[model samples]
Target: MMHEHIEALRQRFLHSGDDADLPIVDAHHHFWDLERNYHPWLRDVPRIPFRYGDYEAICHDFLPDDYFARAGNHRIVKTVMMEGEWDPRDPTGEARWATALHQRTGLPSAMAAQIWLDRDDVTDVLAAYRDLPLVRSVRHKPATVPRAAHRRDFSAPGSMRSEGWRRGYALLEASGLMFELQAPWWHFEEAAELARDFPRTRIVVNHTGLPADRSDEALAAWRRALDALARHPNVWLKISGIGEQGAAWSVARNGPVVRDAIACFGTARCLFASNFPVDSLVVTLDDLFTGFKTIVAGCTREERLALFYDNACALYRI
Candidate 1:
């Protein structure tokens, strides 16, 4: 029954439209070593049978080859690797791992390594990882925890006000590294404020700030926040992660949401990203990029190029 449901969802996205053979540069993705890391959330989720070994075992090694195969002929020439849930045992180990992967894959033109700002030694940590050839940005991931059960209820008042966190963010800005914001919808205002405050820092908002479920109020809030963020020319929005927010995974369902984001962020400030392994929880790589193509159908060739390839190259300095 579960397999049947998954198949139906896949077909819904697959049949949405023909794949437009545009060259793509996926801005965000992840690779993991089950043996070396612990994904506590995966184990706690009852619906998924995934374990540390299950990802590699079932996918035959979740490496660049696997990503390229799934991306097919889309010319995914570059990718920016994000930190998966780093092993708590080795907080800085994820950066080391990404460095190794960059050497091996020769694909992730750059990486946005994860750092915990809550830690006292975050400055030292960022300094250490900044030396890696592919390290271009740092992700504090403040939105990893949300206050609301659904994204609609989220607000970032208290979270962004942390003195230590703000100081760490200053450190990231001073180091000339981009800050990747992965917060829920409510945090968009705070994110915009951060962007405005740190004018020199390039802020990349992941998952279109991850809007709440579709509704007039939700759309209005998302638009308001997005518009505010756009006032800061340095802020960029990544159109990824909409599928996972749906009731059930389907690219067709995610299309409008992503389109709304693109419309708000515009082509230059907007970029396409495959949230990969995380997005794999919702749709396959082909379906994900196919959905992206559908959302950007109204764009001109130049606009499409910027969204899919050019923006990423410029953002990550690939």
Candidate 2:
């Protein structure tokens, strides 16, 4: 009975035709080979049973061709590849793999490489990866860390404010590469500070600050942080990452939140991203994009175009 109920809900979201018109550029998507890699989190998280094998079972390996065939119905002209935590044992291997993927697929117009900001020699690391033709940004992914890894006062300024990270960011800025901010929602202020300090760097805020679950305080704090960050002209926000939070959230639940983000960031600085496969765990690709389109339905065609495609093209130099 419980399994049937879950199926019914999934079908409802899947069948919903909300993305008929938008010209999308999926700014966030991932691909991984579980066999060749080790995902520590996936090993323990029983809830997400979809391994690379499962992806193959469901859709034949979640490759670019599969993604284009399934999610490209809305006309995804370009996509930006976000790094899946690659074999951390070899650190630099992910970028090399992504570059190989770029050569093979030719869909990821830009690549957001994963890097460890805590590394002592981050400048050298940045220099090494920055030369890749498709490498447009770097993501440290502070958000994906375990909740226990964070402190109540994450803003108290220590490692985050360190010279090493800032210097590495400076190298990124100098290279004219964008910085994809992927920290938890609460770290918006810290992200904002980085934006302010590195005026020349383009900072793209992934997932509208990744608002915590439907708590009033979380929502309120997310709004306030977005407001503060919006003041910085260099900071842009992506309307992505919603579906992964849970399966219970729907267009009905998330539309207003996305609308509020558009209002705060303005269509020019905001781009729609389908944070794919990760999002697929919660909602179908079509449904996810459909929900986003529905949220921005009230906008004029020109404004909608910017959110759907133009903004991402410019941001990633696609």
Candidate 3:
């Protein structure tokens, strides 16, 4: 019944008028230059266990021209580049590359630089990013287990729960940078505590908390986790990475998750993104954003603008 209602609304929305002209600030995306830079996940022998499974399709170069061509008519006025995992040895290299890329292309206006918060040089790395103009935030995906069943035993060294990690995390506020977190829903409880502990540091939750399992039980737990995280004033959400593994993207399947995220965090705290190239494996940029437009069709124009553009500008300072 819910799917039918959402589909009906989606149909109504498509007929009402398209949002091709809606200016967008893509809050999350990535660019990788495989020929010049080394991304182990893409170039390595045994690929890391990826959620998208068999991602050989995205092993080549992806640049701004490629992005805007795929974007079609949607006016993407600005974008925040999530750090493409460049070699871990040189953490500041990706930000420098993005800065130069901006100088040449004027796309990806800002970036989420890569930094392992738990590393010994965390302060020095933060200081480096503080000097880079392109860096608005930094992403170091906290350690997490593959499945929820293994969470109890998942006491990895760099996990968000570790004191050592928290010590480094506390410095972001002074550095004037936000923390971009890409953890699954099971980790939100810990994330919420981190947010409360460091009320001054802004934290953006990537991928709608990664609700991969869509079963009734799983969704219930996901919602509960989202609720817990949303209680923190410092936490923000990027509405991307909601793609299902095998099933193709669709409004009926994903719209509710989008709506639920907005309900949990509200439009002011939410931002839209195209986790592109990675998501390109599941759906085209056009179709994925079209689904986003359809799902939010009932919202006021101001609210829609906030989701697609204004909120990202405010959050990323783009």
Q: TM-score for every candidate vs. truth?
A: 0.82, 0.81, 0.92
The sequence of per-residue lDDT tens digits that candidate 3 reaches over residues 1-318 is 633553454344345445755777888999989999988898997778789788889999999989988987776778899998889999999999999999999878899999988889899999898789789999999988766465643557889888788889989989999999999998887788889989999999999999999999989888888988999999999999988878799999999899999999999999999999899988999988888999999988778877987788888886
Segments in model 3 whose C-alpha atoms lie over 4 Å from true places: 1-18, 150-155
Per-residue lDDT tens digits of candidate 2, residues 162-280?
A: 56566567677666678888766666667778888888888888878876556787677778889988999999998887653334448788987898798889999999887766666
**Residue 8 Cα positional deviation in candidate 1, in Å, after optimal superposition:** 38
Choose 2 or 3, whichever is better by lDDT: 3
lDDT of 1 by residue, 1-318 (tens): 633553453344345433344556789987766555554443334435421223332332357877777875565766888877665556678778777877786756788887777677787887787677678888877743543553534443335556667777878767888888887766666777788788999999887877655677877877777877788888999987765433555656677777777777788889988888776756778777776777677777667777887788788987
Runs off by more than 4 Å, candidate 2:
1-21, 37-61, 143-159, 244-246
Task: Report model 2's TM-score to 2 decimal places.
Answer: 0.81
- Against the reference, the lDDT scores of all candidates come to 0.71, 0.71, 0.87
Rank by TM-score (best first): 3, 1, 2
Worst 10 contiguous positions by lDDT, candidate 3: 5-14
lDDT of 1 at 203: 90
For model 3, the local distance difference test gives: 0.87
Clashing pairs in 1: none
